[model samples]
Target chain A: MEQKKVILIIDDDPDIRSALRVMLESAGFVVGEAANGEEGLKAVQRIQPDAVIIDLMMENVDSGSQVAIKLKEDKYPGPMYMLSSAGDAVRYNIDARELGLAGIFQKPVDPKVFISTLKAKLGVA
Target chain B: MADSSGKYSQSVLSKIIRFFLRDEEGSFPVFLHSLRLEDQLYDFTIVRFSVAFLIIAGSLFAKYILEISQLNHYALIILAIILFFANTINFLIAYPARKKKEKSSAYRFLLIFILHLSIATDFIFLTIALWLVGGVYSPFQTFFIFHVIIASVLFSPLISFAYTIYGYLLFLTLAIVSWKQWLPPIFPIGAVPSDAPPTGKYIITVAVVQGLLFFLTASLTTHLMYFLREGQRQIVRINKDLERLCDQRKGFLQIALHNLRAPISAIAMHLQNLLYGYGGELNDNQKSWVQRSLTRIDELISFLHDLENLSVMENADLLREANEFGLNDLIEKIIEENQDLILSKNHEIKIELPEGKIFILGIQRLIREAILNFLTNAIKYTPPNGKIIVRAYRYSSCVRVEVEDNGIGISKEDIPKLFREFVRLKNQKREGVDTTGSGLGLFIVRQVIESHGGKVFVKSEPGKGSIFGFELPIHIKK
Candidate 1:
């Protein structure tokens, strides 16, 4: 029996997190949720999900980017994805891949494509 | 009988004065180009009064000294008459041009005519007075130099030279006629037996020397005036270039600000998610409608981006190519564009337009954008089922178009800051609706209206209603 792959969703908005959780769960991945950047960081330390999804703007704007930088400094070996409502990662000039991020997904994420990209980065069969 | 005669004589005197000071036919406008028309008229008035005073005082002094033979009293009387005519003609021209505030080429020509006639008349009268005194040896010959200097300062080099040559000829003609005894001799009142009029070679020497003095004065003064004028023109040219550079810099700043944050990013994401079925499974009917709505939203985003840049451009010549447009047709199209939003909100829009065409001159696209912004703002702030009234009518010399809404009106403090860029008011809420905006809409609206030489107005009160409008000058074709 294979362990169910877990994905952690980090966003301040409840609606955004639940929609993403439902989509990821239906795609055959176990999904956990964190309400803000600080809770997301604690979840990363405790559960250590297969991949972490983060919203770029939280109660403190740029909180998502701060999480990524902190993970890199702590030598946390896991994939991170940044989500934003203002702009794309590339347009905002945030080099997600260089910051040890798997990729970025914009708000109201396209579930199929986003899941497929994340699975590819994680080397899922 | 006395009153009628007095009125009749005044009318006749005015008629003669007007005839003398009328606009000169075919005078060159090029001469008036460097001088301010109003200043030239003012200078003419000053010169006329000063010359009249100098002539009166000079002739009276020479009379008391008995420097002339029998023609002393005659010279005094003739000089007085010339002074009166010169001052009267000047007053006639200056007062009317000043009162009417006339800047036409004809008015300018009238000023130049006053300059020419006054100079000629003063020189001719002074020369005759000098002739009645001591002919070629009169002490007042130095005044011709003063006249030449005044001519050079008032007119262009060519015109000044012409006046100088005319004065020379008049003086020479008077000297020759008196010397050759071609005209009757009226000797000075107290001329001694030995005080014979200087003759032949002596008189010729005096005439040639005076001619040289006139030419020198005209040349030097006219040359200096042209140099000063050229310097002023260069300064004006530099000032215009600096203004254009400043406008370009402002345009750059606007572009930088517009691109700094992508305001449409959230809308793009949500629309993409719905159309691609990321939000959840959708019926075939739902998928088709979302896709269509997405296309329209994309178009609107691009238009807003374009407007963000366009509002900051202040190039006058580029915006001057305006065409006639009907205000009613434009409003109809704007309403049609926002049909879906209005329908979603269930808002009742009341449109009141005057009969016939309300035509105005402006860039149609810009005016359309302005109206679109106002309408969009009204729809956004108004609750579902709220009323909107759009009215267009002619007000005084301008055509005013207004959008009035009974919605969550702006507070008194926020009204003053509404037109500023990126200034969204705090604590904005209306029941279940939460308003989100970039705050660039009204800023663009004010920019568009003001660039057309028009004004924008706003009247709003908390919770009652808000009215936003602009007035544009009506374009009447000849």
Candidate 2:
């Protein structure tokens, strides 16, 4: 049996995390969730998921950037996808390509497109 | 009711004090006093005190001189003391009198006329003293022109002429009295001057000189006053126009900001859900489309942010908390952060920064926004293979930052309004570049610079490229 690909969803909004978990699970990937950057960092350390999706503006403001920066510095070998609101684009000074990002998913994420993007980035197709 | 009455009484007391303190040359006292019973009482008290002071001073000076006057010495002394006492009694009686009257133009005219009358009386007395002593040869007559000049300055020609006529009449009366020997020849101390002219010629010469002085002084003063008044009127009109323009600008900004909020919020909300996967799973093609949507949303968000900043700046409440930061560090951070966008556009960003440390005092967030806005515009406008140069140098008292682009430059006509909100350059409009700009980038840039007591200047011409530069006061700290 092929092992299930694990995906971590880090977002301060519970609704977002839950919705993303449903979409990723339905797409045939194992999913984990964390409500903040700190929790997300710990989850990444424990699970070392195949892919990580993080929200740019979280509880502490720029929490997702902090997580991404940490993951990059620590040489986390997985594709990182950033989920951000339109407002966060300028606020977090986010440049997806420069940050070694697989892609950026702006908020109100289209479930069909996001799951497919995750599947592609994670090589789950 | 009692509280209001108490306040009213206090107000009355204050008015009375002001009435006494103010210069009383015009019907200002009568006009002010007529409004309320209390003010009238105050005015009367002030007038009585003034009259008393004059009478006492006059009597003392008269007693010391002119010992052999025709009038009885005892009668003059008695009359002066009586007048002084009468003034004091009137002042005491008027303090509580409460018969308020409406302000009337008659009162204003009378007050002004009385002021002129008193001045005329003073001139008459001086002329009489001069005529009694030796007429035209009197040193006092030489200074009589000074009084005419002063009258011309303070009063209108009509008033001055009226006073002059009164002066002449008093002089004539005194001359007649001296001629008939009814008044003593209070001249020469003991021996009349041997060169003394006949009294008629002396009087005529004095009258002629005074009349000429009065007319000349009056005309010159009138012209001078008219010129000053006209200049003051022009200044007042200009200030009024500036105030109206400022008010209109404020109104425009208010409406613009209010109109922009709804669309920006809608875009943000929709973009939020799409980025968070709220709908359903997607394919690779769908993923690309969603990403494009996200980029569009980002552009709109940036535009709205610029609009908000411009509104804040217009209100003069753009609060900036200053911190010391290195210019090169910030520029590098921006470049490092925006490398992907630059690469995607197939453009190059060249940096020519000073090696030495250049520190500036600014809010870190605002400076970052301003620089990022400039860089974004540079990238957006520059064509593929275009170049952007971000340069910084230390000039006297300031640090200059220049962002030069070898892209389409603004036309000369549009340069003047380049830093105004919602003002796109004519060239940019003609080039038909689908720039997702708020047309507020340079506006915000100028505002931020001005708040720092600095300035932003742009040099651009059609097709020649443009250099947007700003200078900030250098901060030695850090």
Candidate 3:
């Protein structure tokens, strides 16, 4: 039997963290959650999940994106994705690919697309 | 278009004109000459020549009253004819100048040369006429004082000094040459008695005194104009500095407002997930509360959006990107955005646009935001099954856009307060309408329109429809 892949969700909003946890769990993957960027970094070190999803904005402005950079520098092997609800990605002139992000999802994330992308990132299929 | 060789010829022609007019010889005592002086110089010349005409005509009568020579009479007549021709040329130059407010320096210099040339030539002819009348003893020599004064007021001290030197040398030479018997005796009246004061002594004395006066007048007038010009330049610089500060502050405020949107957006997203059951099942009561919170959060987000828009509209950098875009395209987009709301209310929305596209130069995003505000207001106020109409048409030099609605109309007194920031009418929160609004909608609309050099107008009466619109200058396609 294969071990179920784990994913980490980093966001300041408790409701969003709980929602992501439930969605990922129902999709047959284990999920870990952190309330802020600081805790998110610690959680990534301890759990070393297959994929990481972080909010663009958290306790501090752009904290999530900054943490992703820090994680990449730390050589975290998990793929990172960015979630934002601050209008469009183009509005901020950010290219996820150039930032070492696997992808960006606008919230509220569509369940079908979010789950599928997560599966691809985890290579579950 | 003409190539470099053509431009080269143009520049060469300008140089020749400048040299002949002696314009390139003088540096201004102040920056006054750097400003557009074509109109000012032209007007001054017209007035000066007209006065010269009057002086010559008046002197003719004076000479006759005193019974002077017929030779003096012919000299005065010839001088008046030359001055009249100068005034006519001055008048012709004004036509092209009035048509084009900003002339190229070359064209302006040409016009300036023609004007100065006419006046300068008239002065020379007048001096000869004076010498021919009485050599050193011509009573009309007083006119030299007036010429020096006018020239000093209109041009730089150097030009005035040049004019003074030219007049003094020519007058002195005429007297000396006549005294030496090298030219005909310029005694238009009877010859001076042989016993009278020596003509050479009188001529030299008069020339020295007149030249001193010319130099004094030029120095004084130029100094006064210099002080006046420096004061004007200082005021212009201060005004520019203040405008720059305003733009900087607007930019800071816009960035802060956009930053505020990020957290609010995250809050709204979390609330939406809760309402949609992404975080497991919720009771009907819990779901209703979450939906209400989401609606309020959305309102805050929109208010921040309006604030960002207001700041951007005030930004000077954004104004430079204004480009020509179709009026019909903007109106159609606004209608399409509100299609759902329009259908929900069952409103009969009609669009009246020009036969073809009407192009106007503006920041498309700002203009679109303004029209959207008006459409949103119309949809918000109009009751179920009500009528809404959007119209765009050319109005003289501008394109007029209008949004009309048969909704709960505003009173006469309230109309004036409509565009004021954070102004929501008392009676606007009627039943069966989503009254949640930032109140900055109309204010933003007015700011955007006015920034584009346009005007906003509103017309309404209680229980009748409201008509809200703006007019923007049309862009004539190249």
The C-alpha TM-scores of every prediction are: 0.46, 0.45, 0.55
Model 3 DockQ reads 0.10
Candidate topping lDDT = 3
Off by over 4 Å in 1: A1-125, B1-227, B243-313, B316-320, B343-346, B383-385, B394-398, B413-447, B450-454, B473-478
Better of 2 and 3 by lDDT: 3
Clashes of each: 6, 22, 0
Clashing pairs in 1: B68-B188, B68-B189, B69-B188, B69-B189, B70-B188, B70-B189
Candidate 3 lDDT over residue span B291-365, tens digit each: 798778767766766766666555534457778888897787657534544665678999999987889887776
Encode model 1's per-residue lDDT on B1-478: one tens digit a residue.
1343234234666556445443344222222233565556655665566666766776666567655546466556667766877678687777677557547887688777776777788788777776766666666678778888877877779988998999888888878877887866666545423355558897688788888888988889899878977887898999999988887877775556345433344455455566666567789899888767765655455345444434433443324657787788878755753454465567899888888877878777677767766786788788888899888998998989899988889999889898877677887787734366666667777877887878888999988889999999988765
For every candidate, how close is chain A to the native chain A in TM-score? 0.90, 0.93, 0.93
lDDT per residue (tens digit) for residues B217-247 in model 2 = 6677767755765676798899999999988
Error of 2 at A110 (Å): 14
lDDT of 2 at B115: 44
Specify the poorest-scoring 10-residue window by lDDT in model 1 chain B: B25-34
